[model samples]
Every structure is written in structure tokens, then in C-alpha cells.
Target chain A: MLWAYLHCYQLTLDTYTPLQQGGSADEPTVVYHENSNSVVQMNAAAKQHGIELGFGLAQTAALCPQAHIIKYDKDVEKQALLSLAHQLYPLASDIVINTEHSLAIRLDNLLQYYGGYDVLWNTLTHEINQQGIHYHYATAWGIEAARVLAKSQINQMLRERTAITKCLAHCKLSYTDLDSKALNALEKVGITSIGQLLTMPVHELGRRFTNDTIRYLTALRGETFPTRTLFRPSSTFKQHTVLPFEVENSQHLLPYMGKLLDTLSHYLRARNLTTSSLCFEIQLREAEQQVMPVSAATPFTCATAWLDLVSLKVERLVLQQPAIALTLLCEDFEPIEKDTNDLFSDRFTHLAQKQLIGRLKAKLGEQSTQLPALGNSHIFEKMTVYQAQGNGQSYGFDAAPTFLLDHPKPLSVASRVCFGPLRLQTGWWEENTQKQDYFIAQTPQGVRLLVFKDTESKWWVQGVYS
Target chain B: MKDSLSLFNNHPNIWRAREQPANTSRFALGIHTLDEALHGGIPSAGVVSIACTTGIGEVSLFQQVISQQRKHKLRVFINPPAHVCAPWLTTQGIDISQVLIITPDNDADALWAAEQCLKSAACHCVLLWSKTMAAKTARRLQVAATHNDALCLLFSLASKKPSSLPVSLELSLKAHEANLTVDILKQRQGWPVHNLSVPFSWTPDNHAIQWAIKNNKRKVHSLHSVS
Candidate 1:
């Protein structure tokens, strides 16, 4: 029944910082929520300047004028927490994103893999520190108790329920999940520490306060609280970024586009899916938008392959106006089984071909390379049509020459007929009608050709049978 | 030079020039006399150019190559001057199912398709028809074919004069009376061969054609009466 809780105290602040841009970004930062009228989070630099969590926004501004304040976005914080949960998903199966700022994972299965609880705790804290994120974590026999201990800033590992009970006994009642009115009433009755409230009779507490207070006390001590919804990854990814300035050249927008691609890569890896099409929209300053789509010949999961294709497409674009922002949207994806290569297989050759074809299509147009496919017509011109690969159907028909002339030329010299009086005069319903008798013939010289005579008795060389 | 040889004898690990192995594995050209002239046949990689004043036996040569390579890999034809007739190809025992025809609008696309198909290894043979090509472009196609172990055959409607292209084999075909005479101008590490006469035949049986015409006439008459 051992469970672990991870609380990212500065989830809102980290979501707004450009940490992946790889430059020095250590500044006094705070996320101020206007609707809640409080400072939701602050980095250490802001804390050093006397800015604290839960302070009024105006009070924080007054206390620390040097703080870099950003408006808080709850959706960003939730997405960041979801991403963090996805990263920790391989470590455990039953992961619950408890709130916008915290996650809870059952750790019984993870302890066996990490060898011990001490090593797991050290590894988790070390990774969080390396990611430049502020977090507090604790493990207990109950998930709710672990969450309460984490919120109360008591970072320790409790093996037994009694140890958790003992730890909660010393803590004050302010850290419980009970409502504020219940806490105020409890404080008025001289019950300060959790031990005092636990020592009191349950009926007496129930008589004084509502049943919710007694229930809260019970849940804090690992009695109830079992209902939880496990976190599942979303199906689609939509991310956008506004450039710092008006970008006239698409090459300059690559770095900003890179950030969105990183987020998309993480999303794809978490769900084990690959995308075939990606649509990018650039919002230009001329009151119009440019929609560019990059598609792959085959479904792919590698992020660099997709990025290289997108870079080539961007390089070939001729922007009509300066762009102010860009958005990347990908909704259609196919689930793919992970590839397992054998020892004697030429796996790289196939991969190299796909990549080469993809790059060539990106550089040249899609129609530059075509494969022959059977068309649904009996006429010579329409019998076999050249189409892009995977875009046509195969139809069985009569025998025809491997090459036909682009234009049928009038032949003056006579030739001996070898095979065909195959008459083909069927398209009368269309504007351009043809009525001709075709023959496969060879001249006195060694050239073999396909000759046809129209209704006007004019002989023409349709194609050479070479 | 003697000291160097002694040094090589003392230390076998020292690097020296090794003898070039003879290329034995080749794709038979399907013509017995031409195969003998070619020592065995064409190497499975590199370029073979057919230079001619007029396109006399070019189509027949293409048909032979296509049918031969059809069983092993995809046969790609890039930008022939006319539309390829599939029925004739299928009649020559070429598998039309494995044949892909690319119709590029210009020479650049033809060259590009040739290079890409050679490098992809998806196609074992690529046949390109172009009026003219730069020496650099021809060399690029040669290298790509050699690197990927695919065959490249270029049928040119130009002269057979000496050029800077590193073509492994070059043959000039002249349309003589009732037969095709092919002159081997260049062969890698082999003596030049004189004109060799070859026979060409591509006509269906008389009874087969008669039977086909009878069915076709019946279909036409039935459609006319119904209309």
C-alpha cells in the first residue's frame, strides 16, 4: 500500500520560462493570478527578495519590485503537470495527477526495480533538481497521507502506518484537507496540533463541527479516500508560440518552431503513435495567414526526420508578408508497433530509402517522381497513366507498346505490317474524337513501329516498338 | 622498391596494394553472342551506354533489359519520348506489375530520378533516355549505381564519339539490312569487338492474331447493333 506524492511547487513559473532555449535564465520570477488576487508561485530569486506564495499580488509587487512577474495560466500548469506525469509513467503504471500542482504514484512496484526506497527517493529528487524544477516529495503507506505530508514540507519516507500517524500527530491541523470554516472552529476550541484532535473523542468532534471535519480527520489518518481517476494521455497535440518580433524570413522562425516540436515529440512518445501529416499555420502581419502542410511518404515516429522535412519545406517557402506568430496542429495519427530489427537484416537500407525519398519530395515537388499505374481506359493515351506512388489503382487491360510517341507523326514511306489491324475508334462522345486503324509494322531498315491510318486515309507513326 | 618489398615481407600487417578481384557475377544480356563479346555479361552495377545515330534497335534493347531484370527487382523507365505501351511489354514476357514509368518534363527530373532510383536499391535496374547530358551528371549516375549495386542503362539518340563520362561499357548499334549490327566501342579491361549481327523477332502467332481480331470484330458489331 506504499504510495509516493510529487508536488511541483513552482509549476506555473516553470511553464512560462524558456528553459529549453539553453541560455542563462536565472531571474527573480513570479506568477501572479489576477482573478485569485494572489501570487501562485515564485522562484528562489523572488523568494530571496521577500516574495512568498499565497501573498496578494499587490503586496508581492510592493515587497519585491525586482521580480519578473508573469500572468498565471492554469491550462499551462495543468499541461506541464500532465507532461511530468507522462515522463514518470514508465516508472509506475497507476499515476494520478492529483491537482494542477501535484501528482501521486503508487510506489510498491517501483521499489523492487530501484532496489530500495532510499535509492528511489534520491533518484527522483536528483532528476527533478537537474530539470531546474522546484519540487517536494514524500512517501507514505497511504496516498492521501503522503500528499498531506508533502504539502506540509515534511520530506521523509515512512514505512509503516504508525510512522505516518506519528508524523501527522506532531503536525498542526492547518495542513489537513478540511475546509477553512472547520479549521477556524477547531482553532477556537483549543485543538492546535493533530495529536490533540486525534485524542479527542470522535463523537465530541462530530457534535462540535460537521461530519466533514470528522471525515477529513479520518482521511488524514489513512482511513478513507480511495476514489481516484488515473491520468490518460490525450490523442491530439496543438501548440503555438508568438515570436518576439515580426519575422519576415521563415528561417528565423525555426528556433521557435523547434520548441513546439519538442513538446510534440514528447506527446508522441508517451502515446506510442506516429503522425503522417502536420499542418503549420503562420499568422502574418498583413491580416492573412499562410497555411503550409508537410506530409511524409510513410508514417514516422522520429522527431528529427519530421523536423528535417519541415526545415526543407520552410526553406522553399516564399513568404508574402512578415509573420507575427505560428501554430502547429496535428490531429491525425496512427498507432505503430515498435520495430524490432534482426541481426542479419538490412534495416538501414530501407530506412535510408524512405528518408531519401522524403527529402527529394520535399526539395522537388511531389509530382516530380511518378510510378506507372494502370488507368481505367482502353484508349492508348489513357490506358497507362503516370501517377505518384500510392495514389493510383491497377487495372488490367490489353497489350500495348512500352513507349508511345508524344505526337503521332505522318509517315510517308511504306512499311510491311507484322501484326495489328487492331481498330481503336471509340471516343465519339468526347469533343476530341478519333477513328483509326492501328498496325505493328517494320520498315525495310531494322526499325519496328506502330502505324495507324485515320478515316481520311492518312498514315501516321503512332510510336516506335523499340 | 626492393627494400619496401622486404619490409612488407617482414611485417605482414603493413598495408600494400592488393590485387583486384575479377568480377564474375553478372546479369546475362539474354543474347548469347553479345554475352560472349561482353566476356560474361554486364556487371550488376555501373553504367552501360548505347550510343546511336538513330533509335533503330533501342526499343528492343530496352525490352530485353526490362524483361531480364523484372524478375529480380523493379524496372524503372525515366522519361521516354513516347508513351510506353504495356501490352507489348507484357507480350515480351516482361512483368508489367514490377515496371514503373516516370515521365519527367525535363532532363533534370530524368537525371534526378535516375540517381535516386540507383541509390534507393528498391529498383535493381534503371533505364534513362535523354537527348543530352552533362559529363558531371553522367558520372554522378554511374557512382550512384555502383554504390548501390544496381544497373543503369542509358539509351542516347546522339553520336557514339568519345566522351568524358566514365561509362563502364559502350555499344554502338547500326541498322543494317534485315539485321542489327552492334559494335562494341569500349569494354572495361577487354579488347574492342567488331560488328556482331543479331536477330530480333516480336510478332504474335498468325492464329493468335486472327483469333483476337475475330473477337474484337464481334464485340464491335454487337455494340453497333445494340446502339
Candidate 2:
């Protein structure tokens, strides 16, 4: 059972590069843990200026005054590690994110499929180099042993138990998972190296040290295996990007928003899914955060199409404050529907119609376009309804006027009646009853109208034949 | 001189009127007199401008043509004067499912929506009701309709004199008693016809109207007996 461990020592620095502003290549950059207030990672330029790890902020400033400082976030580092693991998932199936900056993979099962260890290593290195992250990797008989060797920057592959034990002997106690108390206790006893600690009997050491120390020694020696949760890709797509500079205009946010959409498109295509809507949460500099939702008439997985719709919506948006950050979230995903087309059909009319509706809705409001529907009502106004596509019923009616006025106008002039005194009385159950005698009237201009006289003896023109 | 003349003749942007395609498909207007006057019918794919007023049976005159053109295809209405009654459209044999209504707030959006719908090639016909339109905008709509094989009907309020616009057909409608008077203001390949009468059945004899009249008489007779 060979376990390969990878440690991303400069994870915070690597994750910060994509989000930082355009800075000079020679400028030194350093990331410090906010809680500890000590430098965790630094670029080569800072090292050249005599900066070291664990240096306090004041000390680093005194060393390299021109260095760029960034606060380290554990969650961001974890997310970056998870993304890296997802990239390596196809190459190695059994992967465990052992720590915030390290992962362990069981590679013995995959050696046969890759035909040898060198090809697998080449493939893994190629993928890691493509991401441009600095990493240290090592392999041993046990996961804990491999992790210790990787953390100590001993980059090698070992399959024999003797070789792994020989390498483990040189690793110091500080690289192990021992607490500071255990380290101090071992130091007092003159045991500084893992080689010295392993030579002692377990029962004898059990009397000298705590149970946790003994367990750590036993796991490092491949006596017991630690249970670890394997890494699995997330089902939903979400990306949060911190803008290097504040954007005042909504149009300027497109380039940043477009990058996030491209990532989402890649994720969706990898999973063979499509989404109908996306919600963008814009973090403003001073005002409250705004959530802009862009939806498509049909499910889509292409980035350019979504970008077109988003640009149209963003063009009409009014920005209240400068935006400092942006988060894109899409939780619901649907299986891509296979489109069936007839061989003789020349035009993609259905897709074109959906695209037209989506464009109109993006420019105008969502409720601007509707399909005509019929309702079950006696009132002319209530009988015709306009609703969204695919949700209305169609019922045939008798002869009626072509156009109905939204508000009936009062009949002030006299006109000759051509047809009926047809009476319509409805809405009794709701207590808003109506009774009217309707007629087809023609004015002197030869324009025919649908007129009605209510019980109050007032005449109203409801519609026109045209 | 000969080389330049050939170059001028071969230019793509220069469109000569006599070079217009002659065998374009036509949809019958369903009016005998108007069909005869048009030689075949309305051009299936181009701009047709009509100058008329509301409540003049102008919509009724085109009801037959719209229904016939909208078979298994979408029809869009951009900024109509009033709410189009679905029941009336259904009674005229129009598929209500294929009708789309877009009510834009301003005329600019209305014209834009019309052009998009025509260019999409998904719609069979587009109807737009606006007071006035610029000549450039009309030409754009005409080009879009011709290229995509879609029909655009521009309805404007009738003026005393006609304005020149690059449209395939232009007609002025007047409401006569039980008939619509159509005067062909312009046509692409035909002479202008004047005062062509097309009759419409405004008041059809139906059982629903007859039953209502009889019911009203019964109510009046019963009231008189009680008094």
C-alpha cells in the first residue's frame, strides 16, 4: 500500500496572484497569518532581501520595506486545495485532503492502469505544473510517513519498507504531528530525531509519554491506519472573486464577471449539465450588497450566450456604489436535453424563438412578453388574459370584437344600434355583480363598436371591431 | 470609361428597381377585389404599410390574411393600440398559442422589437402600430423582412397626403358602410388602384344573438304582465 502525499507550501501566495492587481514582477510579495501575525510565505525577491519565515510584520517591514503584504485566510487556502484536488481527480481516484495545504493519494491501485510509476508521476506533474503552483511531494509505505516526508521537503518515491524507515529516521520530531508539550518532554529526554524515538519499545515509551505521542509514533511506523474522508467534487458551482480595484461603473464589472462565467461554463460542461438562471451577488464598497439575477428562456451551458444576456442586463443596471467583490452562485442544474430535429427541416425555428424571447426579456423586463390566453369569464376584459409561455388554456368563443379597450369609455354621442341588446349578468358569488345590455353600435363615421348600457342607465363602449 | 461602368454596375450596394426578384411567394389577402387589384396577393415576405384609424375594421380586414399566414408558426404584435381579444382571434381560426404580444413603453423599443422578431425567422408575421416612423427605420425593417422571409405590417394613422417610404406595398384604408375602401398608394410592380371596395361580415347571423334578443323580449313581457 503506497501512499503519495502532496504539500502546497505556498498556497496562500499562489491563490493571491490571480486576485491581486497588476504589480511589477520584481516586487516582493509576502502572506502572513492574521491570527499569528507572522509571515507564512514569501516570494524569492523577499528572500533575497533577507526575509525569513515566522518573521513578525514589523520585522518583515524592517527587512524589505517595499514588500506587498496580504492576510492569509484558512478557508481560501482550503478551497484552493479542493480545486487542485478536483483537477487531479481523473488521474488519481483515492485522494484525501489531509490538511489545509496537503493531500494524500493511494496510488498503488492506479500503477497498473498507468503501466508504471514514471508515467503516472509525469502525468501528475504535468497537471500540477499547468496550475503554476509550487508543491512538494513524497511517497512512502504509510500516509503519515509520506506526509512527514513531504512536509520536510524530502521529494522522493519509496516502495520498500526499509527505504521508507531509513528516510523516516532522519526526519525531526518537529515535522511529526506531536504537540509542543510532547516535543519538549522528548527534548528533555534527549530524543530529538524520529530514529531515536522509534528505537525505544512501545511499552517503555508508554510509561514515559502520553497516549497521543505513542499513537503518533505507531502511525508513523505503519502500525495503525488513520481513517480519512476522500475528496469528492461539489455538485453546485460557486465562485467568489475579490476585485483588485474598485469598479465604479457597471460596465466595467463585465470583464471580471465574464471570467467567473467562463469558469462556471467549464464546470457545467464537465458535468454534462445545464442551468437556466444565475444569481450574481455584488459586494459594494459602502452600500448594501446587490443581487442581480439573469435567467435564460431555455437551459444553457455555453458561456458566450450567457455573457450576451448578462451584458444586456448590465447595460441597463444603475450602480449605487463602487463594487469591491463579486460572487456567482448557481445551485440548480438540469440534465442537458437532447434536441431532436427532422432531417428535412432547414431552419432551427424553435431555438431561434427561445433566443428571441430571452433577448427581449434581458433588455426589457421579464413580464414584457406574453402569450394570449382565454379565461372562463363573462366579462370581456376578464375573458382574455396574457401570460408567460406554455401555461395558458385556449377555449373557443363566439363572435366578438377584434380589440377590447382596457378601460371602457363613456358613450357621450348618439349612435345607431346595428345588432343585439344581449344581456350579460355575472359575478354574483363574489358579491360584485354586473348586469348590462350590450349592442353593436355604428357612429356617423361608419366605425362599428361594441357598446353596453348598465342598470344605472349609463352607456359605455367596450370594444371595436377593428 | 467602360471599366468604371462595369464596376458601378457590379457594386453590391446599388440596388436597381427593375432587378427586383419577380417570383417571390405571395399570400392571398382573402379579399376578391383586393386580390385582383394586387395581381396575385400581398408579398409573403416584405413590409406592407397601411394608413388607417382605429375602430375602422382595419384589423378585421387583415384577420383572414394573418390567420392564413400563421400556420404552425409564431405571430408577434408590438405595441397595438388596444388589448387584442383572444376570443375574437380564436373565432377567426387563429391559433392563440402561436400569438405573442409585446407592449413596449416607447416607440423606439417597439420598432426594435419588430425588427428583432422579423430577423429571427421564427415569426411568420409581425404587426406594429406606431404614429410615425423615419424613412431609415422603415428601410431597415424592409431589409430584415425580405432577407428572413417574414412579413411586417406597419399601421400608421391616415394623413392627408402620403409620405415616401421604401416599402413593398402601401395602402390607405377608409371605413365605408359594411365595407372597407382600400386605395393602393404604392406597389412594387403594379399600378396604384383607387377606391377598391372589400365587404366584411360585421354582424353575422348567429343563434347566440337571436337567443339573447328573444330572452330580452320575454323579460319585458313578464314585467308588463306583473304591472
TM-scores for candidates 1 onward, in order = 0.74, 0.77
Winner by DockQ: 2
Task: For model 2, report DockQ.
Answer: 0.51
Best by the TM-score measure: 2
**The best candidate in terms of lDDT:** 2
State, as a TM-score between 0 and 1, how close model 1 is to the true structure: 0.74
In model 2 chain B, the worst 10-residue window by lDDT is B218-227
lDDT per residue for candidate 1 within B140-210, as digits (tens), equals 98899888888888888656366546777778787775567888887775766888987745443155767
Give the per-residue Cα lDDT of candidate 2 at A57: 96
What's the residue-level lDDT of B210 in candidate 1?
76
